[model samples]
Target chain A: MTDTQNSRDAVVIERTFDAPVVLIWRMWTEPEFLKEWYGPDGASIPIANMDVRVGGIRRVCMEMPSPNGPMQMWFTGEYREVVEHQRLVYTESVSAESGPVLSPTSPGTAGGHPMMTEVRVELEAVGNRTKMVMTHAGVPSDSPGAAGWAMALDKLAANIATNRGR
Target chain B: MTTAIDEDRLTETFAALANSTRRAILARLAEGGATVNELAEPFTLTLPAISKHIKVLERAGLVVRGQRAQYRPCVLDATPLEAVSTWADRYRPVWEARFDRMDDYLRQLRRQEGASEADD
Candidate 1:
């Protein structure tokens, strides 16, 4: 689907920071700085390996507390494009510690993999401040993968409505 | 940790949701529980086909079929869908925190730069 159509599925976040583009870029590309703020609340990043060149590999691990105790989620990706202080594009996938885990049905492919997505980050310098627009694509929208979810949610609303006698 | 198992279930849930007809059946169930015949009313598919769709939803833990007398009503179980929604939203807070930290780090760096410039 086109980006416009896929917008419904994608998560687009735009923020302006009172920092130069160079500094903002470092926060994203430098592992030490990235680890400080790259995870959800209550999660920590113990390992972040980032190779800022094109075709370089990036591996990050985010550990969070689960009901069963601590759990680590590994994400591995490759840098498809890296423009200094301006833009970065990567294809990321959830994986095990060893490496990318092949799906049982598709031995060599990660397509249709729910945990896989493409991230595009664009940084623009506005005077000394920086404006960043991050688009997380590959979130299945009305496609077969997510078609049921949209409809199921609608049905759920309907069920709730009927039960409330409204 | 059962993380692998949870991931597998998430995959199954996505796969089960990948069909329009199955989604329609689920929408029907959301109105209330219904037998195979009642669920299949909106679709042109056969009873067996509807049953098959219900089975997929059941396997994904999105639906539960009640065993009542002659009517086996399929009820919508939104727990799994809620999980899916939560997963989708997992990154928002992550990036927000990262940006906040970046702001602090940048302010510190600028202050150091100013101090060194004055010393020079």
Candidate 2:
């Protein structure tokens, strides 16, 4: 009954790109191609060094121009699965720019623990187009800081149901 | 757009809600306001221990206690729960923007490929 409620904890997006599956796969895996459109419309990803192999390092630094100043973020993850144009899974940590993963007790982190999210992309060829289903959700069970995520994701729906029932 | 303070509060709120006992207390309070002893009836915790949990919920802004010491009823505050729900939506916009850029880049790559083929 809380299927919809559970879905609220994650971001699931499906989009069809105007290209074949191969191209779509490249756009996600390759560094140059990923940097071309990895952040906001105007934001530039200064560095996107990706090794598209299982267990390979995926380090990317996104620099965005904000009114306050230039904001920079470094995301470090490892390629969990590399299925070559079919499915790709990776771990993404929204950490400080080129620093340690902010701790759960770190102030202002809000959600406690660094935001360790998993990104899974599935691609299917549909003629000249490619259908992509991307899921950005909590960290894997084995990942560090994931214990906190388990709490954040698990009780949310029940919490909401309890509160909303009143 | 969640600011620094909101994020701080969310962290606090989540930390408070992380405990099973704390969550149960919140659920119990949702039914109606109750004194510390009344709230502790369903649980196997002591009065001071239950009061400690109530203190956490109060700090998280999830509960408020009455002023009268004789009977300060602990009431559930739905405000922080609202924050949790809203925070769930924080990722969609960022991803949408990134996907928009991905779409544009794909189109541009196609055009570049066509241009190179024309050169051949």
Candidate 3:
């Protein structure tokens, strides 16, 4: 079945790959494999620090060539659910290179997307092939305003943690 | 990267929308403009309570009340909603592109495995 049904608020993509389920899972969980195929065309992932467990941290930075210059994008998330090769759920957020986690309620970067969003991935083995379903719910994570908002929130989080210790 | 979307205004718009009462009010307003009393008629909520909802919508630029007129009606501006619509569909394509790259990489991996098996 094709990934033909999806709504605007949440995006769902389904694909079948020739690789076995274990290798597909490794491609996602392992940073080395992830760097080889994560990001848009012509974009390079210089950083892919993934701890691939429940409550583990995931930090990724992707760099792309632009008319003005090469731009780097940073994002961080925590793995909320990890069911080995079958499923994974994580909360993705635009983050600073310093890697401060922003609250879901925190304002987003440009385009008015949510500061934090959730991504769910499910994998199934079909004979020797792997079927993967990925769902990303919330605003698309991009826009140049991310750096400013991330830095401001980084300081805000520091000061707030200083006071609340949360 | 950065476009013209205002971060604060967008936050305010969502915050303004984060209430059931306000959402109901918007749904009611969508039919047409209504006076404060008329808008309050559907709910058991008091006039002031409904008025507070209207104020929030008004502040978010979703509702515009007529001024200098005896019969002021709350009008739905819909511009912010329009802004929301403009950016809503962007997330899907980004992931689609990455998945395209993934498909290519998976093919390459299969090729390498086939090569190694041949060597053996």
Task: Tell me the DockQ of each model, to 2 decimals.
Answer: 0.37, 0.38, 0.15
Runs in model 1 lying further than 4 Å from the true structure = A1-12, A39-46, A51-56, A62-72, A78-86, A91-114, A135-165, B1-9, B88-90
Whole-model lDDT values for every prediction: 0.70, 0.72, 0.68
For candidate 2, lDDT tens digit of each residue in A1-166? Answer: 1233245446778899989899889889888788877877667888888888887878888887889788777777778899999999987766544344443222123233444557888899999999998887643322334344445445655655766787
Q: Which ten residues in a row have the lowest lDDT in candidate 2 chain A?
A: A103-112
**lDDT string, candidate 1, A1-166, tens digits:** 2342233235577889888888788888998888766776788899898988888878789888879787787777778799999999876667544445544333215543435556888999999999998876543322525433444554555565576584
lDDT of 3 at A30: 91
Each candidate's clash count: 1, 1, 3
Instruction: Summarize candidate 2's per-residue lDDT along B11-112 as a digit string, tens digits.
Output: 567667767788788777777788888999998888899999999899989999999878899988878777666665887887888889888877787798
| Candidate 1 structure quality by residue, lDDT tens digits, B31-97 | 7777888888888888888888889899989889787977878888878766665554665565566
lDDT of 3: 0.68
Per-residue alpha-carbon lDDT of model 3 for B3-52, expressed as tens digits? 22343455566566666677677766666788988899989999889989
Query: Candidate 3's residue-wise lDDT over A1-88, tens digit each?
Result: 1221333345678899887889889888998898877877788898888888887888788888879787677776778899988998
Worst 10 residues of 3 chain A by lDDT: A144-153
Off by over 4 Å in 3: A1-6, A95-114, A139-166, B1-13, B46-48, B70-72, B82-88
Among residues 3 or more apart in sequence or in different chains, the pairs in candidate 1 whose N, CA or C atoms overlap within 3 Å are A144-B18
- Error (Å) of candidate 1 at residue B16 is 2.1
lDDT of 1: 0.70
Answer with 2 or 3, whichever has the higher DockQ: 2
